[model samples]
Target: MATVSLLDVGKTFPGLDTPALAGISGSIESGIITGIAGPDGAGKTTLMRLMAGLLRPDSGGLTVLGREPLTAPELRLRVGYMPQKFGLYEDLSVLENLTLHADLRNVTGKERTQTFERLLAFTDLHRFTKRLAGRLSGGMKQKLGLACALLGTPELLLLDEPGVGVDPISRRELWKMVHELADQGIAVVWSTSYLDEAEACDSVFLLSQGSLLFSGKPKDLTSRLRGRCLHLGGVEGRRRQALATLLCQPEVSDGVIQGRNLRIVLKDGAARPDPSALDISGPAEWKEVAPRFEDAFIDLLGGGPGGESALAASMQPRAEIRESLIKAEKLTKSFGDFTATDHVSFEIRQGEIFGLLGPNGAGKSTTFKMMCGLLAPTSGRAEVMGIDLRRSPARARERLGYMAQKFSLYGKLTVRQNLEFFSGVYGLSRTRQRQAVDSMIESFHLKQFLGVTTDDLSLGYKQRLALACAAMHEPDILFLDEPTSGVDPLTRREFWNHINGVVEKGVTVMVTTHFMDEAEYCDRIGLIYQGKLIALAPPDDLKADVASAALPDPTMEDAFIELIHRQEAS
Candidate 1:
């Protein structure tokens, strides 16, 4: 049965020239997960709102559960909608939030008790019932929001990026829970920017710039690129350089580094170029690989921008240094009796990309804050460019650049204004500020958005602007905290291209991310769990440590989950 149907639905927010959703038509079936997949500002949220009856379509028709959502008030009782930012009251306890939502949904008495017990067990949040929602980790908060949404036992559930910032393990758990819901005959409409998640769905509606591009099984789309995908290996130490060269080739449509290999997609009907014809150093061999959903999605989007990063090309090269550029020596932080970061120690060399990865509440952020001089450690030291952050805070910060997890930009400011402001904050002279701003506008392709407020820019452009602000001053080290969170894969690739370009120019980088695929880009990764550093090694070595007879080719995610499980067992 079709749980929701759209007949040429069109929606245009007031004051906008283009429609948020245009002539979109699709059917969301019962007892299956249907993904609404797209890049940022691709009308996913708009379509979700329309289905939830929070917004009415400006043209055409939309029906939810066999009736017009906006016209049928009773349908609300049979539908559950969890928005992108799930509305969990921060100060309230988990149980309190669940009780409040139950009251709102009219789930009363013994039924409410039974529903709460089932949901708590299903979400594995039973132990944290008395904990404040605000203190929950990213994954726990998401589970809490889901528990609240499931209060009424709605037959139709709408989830908007519930797995956005959670670790891979938590994301897998959420996927399993949602699949179980689907097994119970609930129609699940999952809106997401993660193509991997979309690939796991029963069907997908691919949207871009407010129009439906494809609506079908993910495999059907992936099958379109069956013979075009190939993996290039043998450039072990210089994969980034090799990938850069490969992406510049006219025959290559999309390429990314995957654990010592470059997975690439050839342009439509393009023949494989001989390894000798490529300009990259070292011997390379190409092996045909299975096509993934991301390859097809990028190919369908007409491919990404060519290899070179314009931002990197515009920057001045840094003087090479043989010593560590940033170091954390026995760093520890505590709140009363609880330790946030316990004796974390590491050193990042010049031009190296070092990643700090962990589950939520795992102290990576605490350690990151200490290194950035945003938080004071209880013991030990954080030094940048050989200067201790505690004793030489100003000098240390002057040589460091930080892009926060949330991409902190003044939402009310225009793109040009934010650039100019950051330049001045970084101590650029008047003339240098003008030059830097102009260069950033050109390099980041922000000229068209100069007049537009940053709040209105798409998430991809906002990320570009944030990185431009962070790098405009040409600091020696860059600290990125979940820098690619919530963005699509294409945008992530573009962001990493810029990072690689900068690293080539001798700037050290320290980053933290939940996306294990992105972890492959790091030179070495430090795994933090329960406030302690559990593992530290190159990406390939980490994956090899967890490889087994049944799983010979363990991915970064597999390594991450396995290492954590091993630590717990020990």
Candidate 2:
């Protein structure tokens, strides 16, 4: 059955002439997971909301489960929607939240109990039922939202970036649960900007500017850019900088930084260079490589599709640490019986970016929170620029900037207003605030939406705004937690450009994220698991260690998987 259908659907908000979904037409089948992929402002959410009957389309036909969704009141009962920013009762316990949802849905007695129990088990939140929803971790909150959405066994499900800001293990679990539900004939229309997850879907629809760009299976979509990727490896310092500058030139479509290596693609489809022909002005090395799904996506979106096999082979790696900025000596945090973090230690050198990596229940959050002074450590200690995090938190924080997992600014205020407010909060004088706000608005390309309420802005804009606010004070140390979550690939790239600029200025960064690929951008990484620093080294070292541990040709993903499995086994 056609679980969801839309024909020439269109919508335009008041005062905006451009339709959010311009003549969009598609059909999502029953029991299938349809991924809606697009960049920021591509109308993925608008389409989902329209399909869920949350908004009336300005024109065209639309139906869910064979009925006109907007007109049929009963359809709401059979459609489960988990919005990007789900509204959960923060003060209520996990079970209380679920019970409230059940009460609202009129689900009662044995059925409710059975359903809740099954969901809790599936989500692995059975032991956290007594915890307040507000106090739950980011991943746990996401699971709670999903559980609430599934309260009534809705036939059709709509999830808007459900896995964004969630830990990798939690994401895998969520996908498993979604597939299990789909196996029972549930239709799921998931909206996401993460191309990898989109590639895993049964079928995908690419949206651009409210228009359909492409719709097909993952293989078909990626098949368009085969044999176009080039893998370059070399030494650090001058060589790394030179390569980055070269790859990010106007001639290159995309450049992925992986430790001492790079995966790059040309902007214009062309023949690959011979390994001997690779231009190596610096001491670093290079090598020809195969194309990846991300490479194909960038190629298709930016230039014509095609590539060559000839490429350069790279040499050995050499790294040089400039100066130590932030150092942690056995940093630890505990919540009574729960040891959230234990004896974790690391250092961030000046002008270098460091990444904190781990699975869902890892000690990353606790460690980050402790470093940022959001939580008191149970034991151990940390320092930022030699200032103690415990002894002189305020002094240390004066030189720090933080962008939390879920950043919150005044939603009702305009983007400019929010920027101004944050500037003042960061202790900028009136004149400085004006200059900072104007500079940010211009640089971030937020001028067009300066007067627009932040509430009306899309997820991507919200992230950009949050970043601008964080950068207003230009702190020496920056802490970012999943800053690129839910952002489109293009925007993510742009965001990284800003981050790179910041790092180049001798800023020290400590970031935690679920994007394993992004870990390659860091100069060094610390892998935390079960409140301990399991591994701390350069990205290539970690991967090499994993490969040495018996995984042949281990990529970062493989290393992470092996690391997590080993931890679990022990």
Candidate 3:
């Protein structure tokens, strides 16, 4: 058994005014799974890295497995760490990666073989044993990373955002593996953005901007939302519109839109919609609903009622579809005989913020790359702004903005320098470029960091700069791939504000994300599983459809879980 504790911990990055871990304190029990969850900019990664001995706290004591984490050499043998970005050599085969880790950890032949076999079986990676680590899908790579971390069977495991970008099925499988490890008496401390995943932890530490907010079991969090939730479902437009509209209402405190339905927690559940509620076009579909962990989280975060005025967008003017913002028909891509995308078809409407959702390796990136003309498809067509992606790649590319998942900007460049570089590429006139850069500096809060090099900025700040650059071009559509990964909750919220602002300005947005909560923000979503789209609809509709087939009071999370299980069972 291994115990971890942080007592009044604090860490202030050199040259930064604020402390990343401001007098934080938490503990993890031996032989159980512990979770730390928060928005982007939260000190979750900082705290976990502190415990892993990657960074020393500026103040306070940190102990792991009865030793000082920062100075305990013996502790390394008992502690395994999987970073948010696992640095596996892309050129190495899966087996080679495992072998490298085994050698580094000093595992002998028999122990290595046994551990590798069990891990491969547990992660369902047996068939891809010979594949290059880089060739594997995101979820598979994550599992491979975990396998490396578990090679030594350390007493304590520290994983940072381990499930980010993994598919629903892959997430479930990963959790099952984690639970099994804990059942065998390993102490696992995992960080993630998914509240449902957090719920499975034996205990959780909720952090925000370097401060501990809540520490307790999942039930404790849910208990906070008791009697505050209501569920609604009906015709497509009415349901989504109602949910979206309700979110802006003062009486409604936090809501989630799931395919033609709404799950809301009101300040007063007893309060009813006004009798003279504006009659919308769809059927009169409404109901009182049960609350889930997510509802409780939104409520706790002070999400006010989403009433009629709050959702005024239902009455907003509609626009004609601009000629082909993005078009894909029967698009297919395959590696060997395994299809990554098969006959995928969709047209991204102009000024729409479309979302692509799927488990790891579901071909979301492949689809995104195809549209960007970065990768050629095995079959079918991909187009952007009415220009063929393959035939006139550069012509189609000029009308789009893309933000890669990781920092694509040069680390050595100052914030302003990066902006200037991008502005030049966008071909803005000198006057226009100066104006755009100035506006971005103010809007993105990058003024203070104008001269700071990219490598010196925090991940959240770097992410903001990246988004700012992508938007500098003011393209008709923006493609964001897990843009908010590893960011703290507060920063994630701030990021979404910018995204929502862009959408409000009628700029079409296409995004891929690991956070399910973010999925609710999308006008429409495509659920991809194993390289195929399993479901495509508004969030409320997907939830309502699942609810119709579920036992009474099933939640969106439940519906998603059930849907995946049903697919697997069949």
**lDDT tens per residue, model 2, 1-570:** 688888998999888767788998889987889999887888999998988888999899998988988789888779988887767999999999999999987789999989998999989999999999988877889889989988888999999888777777777778898999899999988888888888879998888888888887877867665555666665445434444465545566677677777666765566543333344544444466766655666676774211210100111121334657788788878787888898887778777788999887788988888888778787888887777778888888778888988767889999988998888877887787787787787767798998999889988899889988887777787899888977888777767766766665556788987898898888888999899898888988988887863567787877777788888899
Give the Cα lDDT of each candidate: 0.90, 0.79, 0.76
Task: Arrange candidates by TM-score, descending.
Answer: 1, 2, 3
Score candidate 1 by TM-score against the native. 0.97
**CA RMSD (A), model 1:** 1.4
Cα deviation at 82, candidate 3, in Å, is 1.8
TM-score for all models, in order of appearance = 0.97, 0.87, 0.83
lDDT of 1 by residue, 342-422 (tens): 999999999999999999989999999999998989999999999988888888888888999876999999998999999
Residue 288 in model 3: lDDT: 58
Better of 1 and 3 by TM-score: 1
How many times do residue backbones clash in model 2?
6
Q: Is candidate 1 or candidate 2 better by TM-score?
A: 1
Local accuracy of candidate 3 as per-residue lDDT tens digits, 87-131: 788899999998998888888778888888888898888998899
Worst 10 residues of 1 by lDDT: 273-282
If ranked by lDDT, best first, what sequence of candidates would result?
A: 1, 2, 3
